[model samples]
Target: MKANPKAKADPKADAAAAPAGSKKKLMIAALAAVLLLGGGGGAAWFFMQGGDAAAEDTPKASKKKKKASNVKPHYVPVEAFTVNLQPENGEQYLQVQFTLQVDGPEQATLIKDNMAIVRNRVLLLLSGKKASEISTVEGKQQLAAEIQAIVQEPFAKGGDEQDVTDVLFTSFIIQ
Candidate 1:
C-alpha cells in the first residue's frame, strides 16, 4: 500500500516538472526576442543619424553648400531680326529672335545702352548667311557662336569686350 502511494506522488511530480520546464523555455525565448529587437532598432537609429563622427569627417553636408554656386547669370532680350539671306538656288529670307546671356547686370546694361550698334552688328552678320547654312541644327549652332563673337566684340576700338556669353534662340525661320 505504501509503494502504491509513492508511485502516485512520483507521477504528479513529473507532470508539474514538465510544465515548469516548458514555462522556463518560453520565458527565455521571449527575453531573447525582445533584446534582439531592441538592439536592431538602436543600430538603425545610430546609422540613420550619420553615425556621429563619420558625418564631419566625410563632409557630406558641406558638399551641398559647394554645389550651390554663388555666380548668378544675367540676360538681355533682343528684338527679332528679318533679313534677306545670301542667294542659294533661289532668294530666301531669315527671321530670328534670341536673348543674350551675360556675365552680369552691368554687361546687360551696356548692351542695352548701345542697342543701335548691337542691332547693326547682328543684322549685318545675318544678312551674310545663306538659307541652307542657317537651316540645319549644326548651322544654327554655328550661327549662335558667330553671333556671340560679334556681340562680344568691343563696342569701340580699345574698349572692353561686351561680355556676351551665350545666344539663346527663341524663334528661328529660314524661308
Candidate 2:
C-alpha cells in the first residue's frame, strides 16, 4: 500500500463514524434490557398467581371433604294413610293421603294410637293454608313439619320423647 501524504483524513469525521457504531451497540443493549425485564416480570407474575390460587383452593378442598365426612345419616320410616275430616262449619273435606317413616317402633306405636288426633290437627292446618301455599313444594314441607309437631306433642306429653324422623307424602290430593 502506498501512503498518500497529500490526502487529508478528517479526525472529526472519524469520531462521527465511531459514534454511529457505539449508538448501534447502545440500542442493542437497551433492547436486551427491556426484553429481560419483561420476560422476568411475566414469569414471576405467572408463578405468583399459580401459588396464590393453590393456597386458596387447598382450604376449600379440605373443608368440602370434612363436611362430607361429618354429615349425619338421615333416617326415616314409611307409613301411608288418607283421612276425611269435618272442618270448621262441619263441612266434609277430603285430604290427600300421607305417609310417614317414624324413626322407631315405639314412635310408630304412639302415632298409631293417636292417629285420630294427628289427622285432625293436620286437617286443621291444611284447611287454613291458602290453596297456593299448600300446593307448592315449600308449603308441603312446612305442612309435614307441622304434622310432625302435632304427632310428637302427644307422645312428648306421654313421656316417650322419641322423634318421628320424617313425614312422607305417599299420596297428596286436595278437595
Give the best candidate by TM-score.
1
Score every model by TM-score: 0.61, 0.44
Off by over 4 Å in 2: 1-94, 155-158
lDDT of 1 at 98: 98
Q: Could you say which candidate leads in lDDT? A: 1
Q: For residues 64-113, what per-residue lDDT tens digits would candidate 2 score against the true structure?
A: 34443344424333343344443543444445666665645555666677
Relative to the true structure, how large is the alpha-carbon lDDT of every model? 0.86, 0.65
Residue 12 of model 1 has an lDDT of 80
Off by over 4 Å in 1: 1-70
Which whole-number lDDT from 0 to 100 does residue 4 have in model 1?
Answer: 69
